[model samples]
Structure formats: structure tokens, C-alpha cells
Target: MKKLAFLVLLIVTVLSGTLVGKAIASTGFDAYSMTTHKIENGNLTNKVTDLISFTSQNIENEKNNDSKLVSINNVSDNVIDSSLSTDEEILQELSRYKDLENTYLMQPGWTSITFDQYDLLPLNSPKPLPSQYRKEFWSHFDGNQKVTEQVDYLISSETGKVPLGVFVNGELTSLWNDGQKVKKDPYTPAYDLYLVSSIQTLVESNSPLELSFKQEILANQSVSLIELRTQFSTTDKQWINIQLDKPVWGQYEKFTFNSQTGLLLKYEHYYVLDDMSLVLSSVTDNFEYSVASEAPSDVTNLIATGGK
Candidate 1:
């Protein structure tokens, strides 16, 4: 009985190894250390090469002589083309956020940005309008910044209508709601604009492994997407960081960055449930950016009157 059991286990192990090898071989160049060379005549050559240095001398000899040429094929798009490697594309996207401190600071001139936020519920339940949905506008000019948030909810006597937070040089100066003095403690610096804070930190640290890169079709447009999974830390309320408050079994986030501008186009945060299903906790989208002549008139008036 012992001998029979040993034979069966050995056969199973051998089959598993064979299956894995076949899977690896199916991925083509992605699984092998191969190199493609272009000759002066436009023909191409592919060889199973070592991962280490392939010197200019080798290239010169390959071009000047054909004796060492093992095989040649016509130029094919499926094999090679002029496009940045995946890692290079990731670095290019990261560089966009390297010098960006705020979304409204996309350029030196006056800037304006607007976006909407939605707090989600389990089982994809619907939310009450204006209460669960929020709209925000941020504009910067000269040395002053204005942020206006709109949400309608009544707390006993006070109406949690629109709250206007004003900032100068990136510090929350004052907050007011319809002539009522609102606390500044809750409104941190940059407020909801902190959506990209974690991403900026990851980019600044220059660690590529922490971020996974991919390309996909979103809204019928091509976008470069980056994803990360880890514990989140923030000093104050930020859209993506709030999901950490739960007994999070697992958490991961996906962000799409505009290739040309480096601005965050969209963000989605998900919590992995016990059944390994993803429940979206929050999402922010409808990003708009443009040059502004100045801050909103009402905001400027409030600042001028010293928030009476």
C-alpha cells in the first residue's frame, strides 16, 4: 500500500510541473529572455539572448556581417514596434505628479477645477440626493484660493447647506456657511483635493513595485491605470483614506491619470468582503480643469469683508 501511494504522488507532482511549464511557454517573449535586432535593410532578427549586457560591438558585427545571423523575418507589428515599455510608461505617468502639489495648481496662471463625490452603501443601494452626493469647486488666483462645497443635510436646527472654506498659501483660513461661523478643524488643508495625496507620496518615493500599471478602455477612451493595495494613513479626512475606518478585510484602489496633464481623471476604492467580492465604498469623478480669471465673486467678497 505504501509503495502504491508513493507512485501515485510522484505522478501527480510530475503532471503539475508539466502543466506549469506549458503555461509559461504559452506567454511567448514575456516568459523568455529574448532580443530583437533590426538590420540596415529593414529585416529583423530574433534570438534567445541572455538578460545581461548586449554590447554595441555585437550589434556592429551583426550589421556588418551575415554569417552569424541565425534567422531573419519580415518586420511584424505583433513582434516589435516603437512604443514605450510598460515600466517606462509607468515612470512617465509618475513624473506628472512629481512636481504637482495640488490639482488647482496645474499651471502658473489662474486655475479652476471641479469634481463630484458619492458615498456608497452596501448591496449597491441608492442614496438620497444632495445628502449622499457632494459637489465641489476650487479656484486659485494671485495668492488666494477658494474652495466651495455643496451638500444639503439638516442637523437639528442648523442646515448643513453649502460650506465655503477659504485658503491662502495652502492653509485653511476660515470656513463659513450662509453667514454662520463654521469650524475650521474639520476642513483640513486642501480638503477633498487630497484625493491624489497618496499617489503623490508613492510617486515621490520612486518605488514602482508598490504600483501596478495597465492600459484599458474607459468611457470609450484609452487610459493608463495604476493600482495599489495597502494600509492607508492620513492625518485628516480624505476621500480615499476614509474606507480604512472599517474592519477592512482587504483594500485596494485604482486611479487613472491623464497622460498629458498628470491630473487624476478618476478614482475608485474597493473593500474586499468575506466572500472575496469587491464592494465599492466611494468614488469621485467628473473632473474638469481650466484657467480661471479669478476666484468666485461671492468668495472674493467674503474674503474682502473679513468673513463678517
Candidate 2:
């Protein structure tokens, strides 16, 4: 057995009104313990971390020395059973969408992405924030030679609903609430901002997200789901589903990708409760797609203001 050099753990943090991904790892195993705090309005809310142990054979719970133990014995060489697709296969599928600028320009389509956030706490807990928060984005791409792209964002929060702004060609080109009229600042939003972008960013990231994810998967027990399923309303389209159980911060995540284009279709995160019940925390769904047309008023007006 070869002792692989320890690589950094990839923690994908979601800051959509909540924070997650708090995992500490040694060589081949990840042991997550400690308090996860949520800061809201200058106040802190604490939640006890659940102990989940992943082994080469299976995942179990071990309570010792007032700490939870998640052990992975000789996991560096462990191969997931033949029934499940290997991490390499998943990465190969993901690599297909790496060239976003080219893919969008060649095929040119628009997608409506809706992100829904639900109550993370238990049902009986007093809610300090809105029970549900909805954020939306519209990404348009013209198949022109210039590869024009524009994204519009709207967010609903405790203060109320408002249009976040617009990003044209990866630049914040427009603003309404801020009264900026025209601003062309480089925009580097979260990977999960859009469905296709989520996949593209993961593949294009300079960080070892793919390697760390593969190491984490191969360094553990069985995964929840890794298979292809037919998408609803589209019999010809197939989607690949990958679900990670208790990967980090006791969060369960499911990722759906277009089997053909490798573009992400959905990403879902669930919070585990004391009673072991799961609460959906956030989800981004790419439900609709259509051919792109002329630029929206936001993008056009921003360019008209000399944001050339």
C-alpha cells in the first residue's frame, strides 16, 4: 500500500444566509467535531455537531473520550464497490462543461435558476429570520462570436425583496438599489450562483476541489447515490445524481448534472436535526432552458453608459 501525501480537504461553504462546511481531517479520515455557530444580527447561535464515522467497510458511530470517532482504515486504497461509479468517472463527466464560454456561445441558451432556502433549525425552534428565502437568477448567452453573457439576480431577505444587480460578461455592469446606474466591476460570485456555473466553477477552480472530493470519497465508506436518472418532462435527457451523506458539518448534499452536457441541473443541501430528521436548507434548480436573444435592458443600458 502506498502512503499518499496528505492533501487539503475541500470545504464548499454556502453563505446563503447561512454558513456550513466545517470539517477537520487527518490523513485518510475526516473527523468533524465542535460547535457550529451561526451569526445573525451580531448574535451567535450554536448547534452541537453530530459525530459520523466512515470506515472502509461501513459508516458507524463511536463515542470515546467525549468525542465522536470517524475512522477510515487503509482508505487510501479502498475502491468503492463496482456497483457505484468511481470518482474518476464523475470527474470525466464534469469535465465536459469546463469550457463554459465556448459551450454557451456554440449552443446559446438561457436558464432560469431558483434557489430556495428553508429553515435549518428544528420545527419547534423560534425563527429569528424568514422561514424561507428565495433567490433567482436569469442567465442569457448569445451564440455570437463575442460570446456575450449576462446574468440578472434577485434576492429575498428579511429586509424585503430587491434586485441584487446584473452581471454582463462576468462584470457587475448594472445596479438599481445602490443607485450606481452603471458600474463595471469584476464579478466573482459563488460557484453555486447558477446551475451551469456551479459545475463549471468546480471544474475550473484552481483549488483541489476535485482531488479533495475524490480523496474524501475514496477515503470513506459507501456513498448515498451515484447513478443516472431520467429527468422529468424530458424523456430524452438523462441526469447524473451524486449524493454525499454526512460529508461535512453533518450536511447531506445531492448534485444533479446533465449527463450529456455535464452542466449542473440542481444542487441540494440538507441539515440534520437532533432527532436525525433532515431539513432542506438550500437548493438551486435549473428547470428551464431556451434560446437566448438580444441583451436585456439592464445589460444594454449598462453598455450604453460607456461600460465598454
Candidate 3:
């Protein structure tokens, strides 16, 4: 239990913010134990030789130490140039993600995603992935593992309420009566494979960004994606000089798109440091944009007590 908590604290250092990939530790920090992480002014430093050499094998059993070779090549030979230079152009480029509903709010189709993580700790060997997850929005998470869940969404655009229910292992455990009120709509974390929300993050930040386009073969077919970067400036008093290649820990959201329609095809996010790396690979196996879902007619008499 201490190791698990330590592992969680270890990764939290890198995932300061963001909801996609949630595992791995940067190279330059020391962990005396799982309970404490050394941080100053929201930034952490690293020098992990001792922990790697001294951690116990008992703890290694719990850590997933898998490693996959990750790289990016130019392949921009045929990028569909969306020349977004000026702020107005950037905003125009970002405006594309205006109202993409959350994964659950998506039409009533099913999605399967496998989220796996790796890192260097007391014991380091690639471990098997945990159970693959199928996210149905309402049953999914709110950033830190708890949030509003659903029964089945049959919202009334006019009444501003939605159908809510609960299930446990493919069985309906309970459900909320239809038309339950939601004071302020619950916000969802970006857990999709396509990393579409990364675009939303940049769009909402309203910050000036720099990007480079590329095309790479993903699962056989060529994919087009753009790298939008938010770099720390060394010249600024707030940031110190550091090489980009040796990022303490870097997380990237590589959104593969259907170039012609500019819609997300797959979500691939990668994070890496000197000793650990993490990946969240996802794709909508199939999406039915025109389909709409209604409340399940066969719900049991038991009403869902709490949205756990």
C-alpha cells in the first residue's frame, strides 16, 4: 500500500496538470518514501541513482516497468498546410474544437481504450497492463478518480436534466430517476485516445503557441498530426536554461486526424524522462455521429444511491 501510494505520488510530480496519461517519474528527483515528494515553487528536481539502486524487490512487483521505443520523424512531406501564423490565425485554428461533447455525451456507441504506464522505481521490469477500460462518460472519471457518473444520458435540451444510472460489472446496480437536475454541468477529464482535449486546452488558454506539422504511419495507415508546444523561456527570469531533448519529464498529445474532415481519428499521448516512460494509446474503433441514445427502458426498481 505504501508503494502504491508512493507510485502515485511519484507520477504526480510529472502530471502537474492534464488527464490523459498518469504514470512514470522524471529522472531528477529523490523519494525517501511514497509519502513525500520534494518540490519547490511548483517545480521538482531529480537525482534518482540511490532510489533505483536501493529500492526493494518487493516493491518492484507492483510497478509496471514496460518500455516502448518512441520517436518522431519529419515525415511532413505532404502536410495539409493550415498556415496558422498570426494570433487570429491561431485562434481560428483552435476554434475548431468549440463544442465537442465529452466521450459519454458522444452518440450511444461503445469505445475501448487501454491506458498503460511505466517508470523506474524500487524494482524495474516491464509489467503487464491492467484491465483495458471502456469509457461510457458517466461511469468514467472526473480528474482525481471521482466525479459525476451516469445511468444513461437522455437529456432534455429544454429541461436541462439528464437520466442517471449506475452499473457494477455489466449489471445494473441502481439508477437515478429520470430528469435529475445538474446545477452546473460536471466537467470531464480528457481520457480519450485521440487527445482531442489537448487542442481544447490550448484553445482555452488563449496563449500564443508554436506548431509544426508531421505525418506518420500509425497502425499501418499514414496519419497527420501537428505538434503544438508551450516551451519555458530561459531568457525569462522565471525559467532556467535546460535542453529540450533532456526534458525533466515531457508529455505530448499527438492527435491523429482524418485530414480531409479535420476530425480526430486516434489519440496517442507519450511522456518520457531519463528512466521512465508512459503511453496512452486510444482510437475510436467506430463512431456513429448520427446516432442518439435514450434512457434504458429495462432499468430495475433500485434507484442509484450515490454517484461513486
> In terms of TM-score, which candidate is strongest?
1
Q: Output the worst ten-in-a-row residue range by lDDT, candidate 3.
A: 27-36
List where candidate 2 sits over 4 angstroms from the true fold: 1-84, 97-134, 140-151, 155-162, 168-251, 271-280, 296-299, 302-308
Predictions ranked by TM-score, top down? Answer: 1, 2, 3
Query: Is candidate 2 or 3 superior in TM-score?
Result: 2
Residues 52-96, candidate 2: write the lDDT tens digits.
Answer: 211211222212333222222322354334332544555544454
Give residue 35's lDDT in candidate 1 (0 to 100). 7
List residue ranges in candidate 1 displaced over 4 A.
1-92, 97-109, 121-131, 141-161, 168-210, 217-220, 231-247
Worst 10 residues of 2 by lDDT: 26-35
* Residues 68-104, model 3: lDDT tens digits: 2222332344544455555445434434432243433
Best by lDDT: 1
What does the lDDT read for residue 190 in candidate 1? 33
lDDT of 1 at 67: 22
lDDT (CA) for every model shown? 0.35, 0.32, 0.31
- Sequence-dependent TM-score of model 3: 0.38
